[model samples]
Target chain A: MALKGWKELEPGVVILEPGNTIEYKSGTWRTFRPVIDMEKCIHCMICWIYCPDSCIMVKDSKLVGFDYEHCKGCGICAHECPKEAITMIEEAKAKAEEAK
Target chain B: MVEAMVKKPIVKALEGDKAVTEAIRQINPDVMAAYPVTPQTEIVMEFAELVAEGLVDTEYIRVESEHAAMSSCIGAASAGARAMTATCGPGLALMWETLWVTSGLRCPIVMAVVNRSLSAPLNILTDQTDMMGSRDSGWVQIYAENHQEVYDNFIQAVRIAEHPDVMLPIMCGHAGFVLGHTLGRVEVLPDEVVRKFVGEYKPLYSILDIEHPKTIGAYDHWDYFFEHRRQLFEAINNVLRVIPEIAQEYGKISGRYYGLVESYRLDDAEVAILIIGSGAGACREAVDAMRQKGVKAGMLKVRCFRPFPADEIVKALKGKKAVAAMDRCECFGGEGGPLFIEACSAFFNRGLPMKMIDYFYGLGGRDTVPSEFCDIFRELFQIAETDKIKPPLVRYLAVRE
Candidate 1:
């Protein structure tokens, strides 16, 4: 629901809740997704540092996978991967491959 | 609050820019970010000197551009800090985008704008062009006629902008060279008095409150945009009542009362001219000169341009035979200058009957002498007697053909 008046605004429109952008579902905007090859991965964490969307997920002191729900697939992660362990895959092909 | 004891200000001779700096020193804001531009350069410079001398404690950041200056103020203001900045003419033009950003976000940042003419021929003179350009940027605009008012208004602005009902930024406008460079007497209040009067700023949402973290300037599409704009309108409209109340409170201490409009000898007058800023001083003289000749002439100086005192103006000019609106800038392709259009609208909305004329004077800092004001009153008198305005109701005063 949209705010209808000044009563709805937090004076000066300062958003009262933070880190809720995860609800926006920016992954729906991606035309391509990055796939990581675990064999060649060195876990340099460069992708974690360079992601513009901050959608890279790392758990238990290791790079697991991208948070596809929020990532826009800007390819910065693949480009920044020092070991060339990541590859760009078309979203349509990735979805079909997932079915197999 | 009793009327028995009131503190009067100590008088001192200071230039217009110095007076504003003196005001800022008394307020002692949390953050001040600014880029130096001429006419207003001295204000930032003096403020910096105060910072260096340990006379005031403030986080002063010298930004690279006017845009960044205002951007820094917005950032500081968003964090529940009292923030302010100053600029003029071209510098203000550079800050155009962020001006809307500051106002749209409802940041209560105060700006001291030394009014100057915009350049095509590269003139660095004084006029109302810069301030008029931002008429709709959602900031409350207050014009000061002299050095004292410049100091007084800046102090009052701190309260007005932070008022809960009117949480909008304020622009304290001083005519460049006219008041900015001239030296005059200004009353300086005690530092404690100003601090008490302004009180502490309390933002409705503080970005620094990590316990309830928040974001500002988030994206909003059509559905929410109109409502947010409506908030700005309601906030500024509240200024019509809030400003006078604040001024009256200020009057109790300083003995100087400010109002939305200042009418001089307008009661029972047949013809009058509406003016703004320092030019009103000359028009007042003209009104007195005309009175010597038994020509019922008067003057009305618009002290508050934004949230304009439309109803008061209509009441002041009602039943008057003729009125002339004098402007310092030209609104090309418009019906008349900015003030002219606004004044006419005020009357037309109320369906009041009166003959009105528009005149553009003092462009690029051209001097408008008393003789010119007398001529305008003469033409207004003719309109009053004949009930007919001279053709081309708008004319440029003291301009070469």
Candidate 2:
């Protein structure tokens, strides 16, 4: 029955799972994948500098695009963009957060 | 923090990184130093959006490094503003030496740490090792399990840290990869509720006047410096009483109460568990399996580990014969788990024959299935029954098979 390392936190407190009410799933809408329109965009990297998640990328010294991996769909870039270039679409619309 | 707001806006599915932005929008925080990290980028981004939209009446300081992020906050807070900043693993690690000085100077600054795993090895998972390592920096730390707790902790930390009796800085961290990414139904309490919860800030030392002359953080030799440390310890001791009072007062309005350690199903159990961060979920699933098998068990979630909570902990585990300490980070050669060893020290002086087991699991997002957890508890119970105690050390799941 004993596996090895796992134990109760105290005599009764637990550091691992104890029951079936599993509520630990990351459902959709937690992600905000941003699409960058290169044409309308001025290379204003305000979003890049201000992003708390660092989900955007500036490649080869040019503002290439956004990184969906860590983007929580906060949409601050779209809101802060001067050119209206970055738009926040749901994660289901394009490549997922993990793929990047 | 909510100053004369008609009502609170609806709860939005926000990230842990975004809590600062929301708090700024609601509180209209006077000054903020914005820095970006992998997971915490959302925080600065949202605040920038608020600044751009003109939604919140606040000034945002766009800083370059994590050091500047905290530096700006320290400067702003001292100049009589509700100042804030955020960082993850490495970024937070960079804010190190400055943090100690900020608190020692008695700045009641509030900050949100998007908890991420530290690395020379480079892993971006959720772990408390970063924040845990900073526990000695004189900042009061509160750990939130979900997005709602994330929001609530920020509101409470500002008031608690700024309280006159406890003019220590506060650091409340959220599990970056989980709550940071987990969008869920978070009920936004009405402005009335929040206002009632986070009362007016009565700053004891925060004063700004061009005409007046004052001195702070002056050069002190060993004679004066030694007294400062003693005085600092006395201030911290006041927090043990102050924190509980604030939590109880906040509970009346919000209908939610948080204590130093949260206990569930531990009253009549023979075995107990301990953990912080989001790893408590794994233990919950495993405990159900043990219960079905007729193993009486419970859990004591250690949300407040710093003030040590010795009395509450002793009350929680006084009768239990075996306790399991789960840790996400190793203690190197010192003990089985880092948090485990810290909690074990509480009991060491008691001279009671309690069997404390330490397990290092779920580090770097290693898959912690419920079955694996159940096996750990079974192993701990076995050790207890046989009256055999292994060396107080860290045990890895890889060693089990």
Candidate 3:
């Protein structure tokens, strides 16, 4: 989003739109990204339940993938996975592999 | 407009505290959260009795501390309620942190600050040290000269604070003991007239609105904090224009006019005194006495302090030969008091070379007689005649050498 001038800002900086935090992409603050191993076969949805930012995606009561746009890359989901089905990878390494 | 012209005022003898209480009764705000502090206690106490009697449908919260008092007012105001509170001296000090938060969040809360001396020496008396301390906290500040102004300013404060152009909190201050404890004649408007004048408080945004959920006091990082704070600056500057318009509207209903700076016999005077709050009455008396004695003396009373009324003040003092800015409180290590410094700065900014000086008096509630003001006027004449300003630009008035 483009930065607003002083006159364009609302009085008191009140957020008029609900759930506008999605506009602020906190994923940019992530030093590490969580990679889930769906093949490990536990769709218990523990990562979905433990993701603090609600970044874990789930459909039909089964875990799908991570919504990295809003994820702050806190390792809570990877640590909470009882089946060890998630791993925290450095963001730079993940991007390097993606580039390759 | 026609109805307001025909509306009659109810004349009553009441102390300044009671006068404010009467105005609050008429405003009948939605919420009042206050704690007891000397000089300011009577206002809330009387209003609480009225609340118990069901005179006004207001939720009066007896907060434990002044901090909590202001905090609760902020909460209620942000929730789209017309909220108010009263405090003085140490109580104002206690509410220091919340004062900034109140304006920063743009909650139009009105607070009656009975001016009193700060502690350490520990005195419960009339002085402007308390409100002057919070002058830069982004709240609109209006001072009253007597019981009538105390009553009138309180009513006007409601509209000024809640104005859409200035969604900022305000502090209406009156001298603690001088006005708060003494009886004076005040002509109050009928309850319905006041109610109609202030009208309904329509908040820009309310937390209670479920259909359009809005977040109040959200965190703003570096990317937007500067812009938001700049908006607050613009809002307060808007007050400089909004106050006079509202005051004019209030004048039509009450038959009492108010301005940012009240110029008394200032047009043809060669020497003048600039003061604020209750001292203005005494200064005016001195100005009248000087005129009777064939001396060209005048006075300017600053009713609104926060917006400073720099242009109006400069215009008022433009042709004067000499002027004195009398302060009830000292600025300690600074060259002069807040009012004096601001006045000098205003004159300097305009490149007006009129001789200006500072006078400190009535700090711990010492009486400032009309004769003492005459002494200041006499000194002004001396400066004007000789064109020589002595050293030690700040003089102590009525203080034992």
lDDT of 3 by residue, B1-401 (tens): 53554465578999999999999999999999999899988999999999999999999999999999999998898888999999999999999999999999999999999999998798999899999999999999999999999999999999999899999999999999899999999998888889999999999888998999988888888999889888888899989999999999988888888999999999999999999999998888999999999999999999999988999999999989999998887578888999989999998998888799999889989989899999989988889889999877998987666
Angstrom error of the Cα, residue B277, model 3: value is 0.2
**Listed models, DockQ each:** 0.58, 0.01, 0.76
Q: What would the per-residue lDDT of candidate 1 be over residues B1-401, giving only the tens digit for each residue?
A: 32333444478899999999999999999999999998899999999999999999899999999999999999999888999999999999999999999999999899999998998978778899998999899999999989999999999999999999988999999989889899999877778888999999998777788898788998876767777888898999999999999999999878889999989999989889999998988888898999999988999899999988898788888888999999997588999998889889988888877799999999888888888899999999889889898798898898888
Residue-level error in angstroms, candidate 3, position B93: 1.9
Error of 3 at B203 (Å): 0.9
Worst 10 residues of 1 chain B by lDDT: B1-10
Report lDDT (Cα) of residue B221, candidate 2.
Answer: 42
| Better by DockQ, candidate 3 or 1 | 3
Give the fraction of reference interface contacts each candidate recovers: 0.80, 0.00, 0.95
List candidate 3 segments past 4 Å from native.
A30-41, A73-75, A78-100, B1-8
Candidates 2 and 3, the one with greater DockQ: 3
Choose the strongest candidate by DockQ: 3
> Would you estimate the TM-scores of all the predictions?
0.91, 0.75, 0.93
lDDT of 2 by residue, B146-262 (tens): 777788778878778877767778888888767776675565666556655566655444437434434445544443465566666766677778877888876655656888888
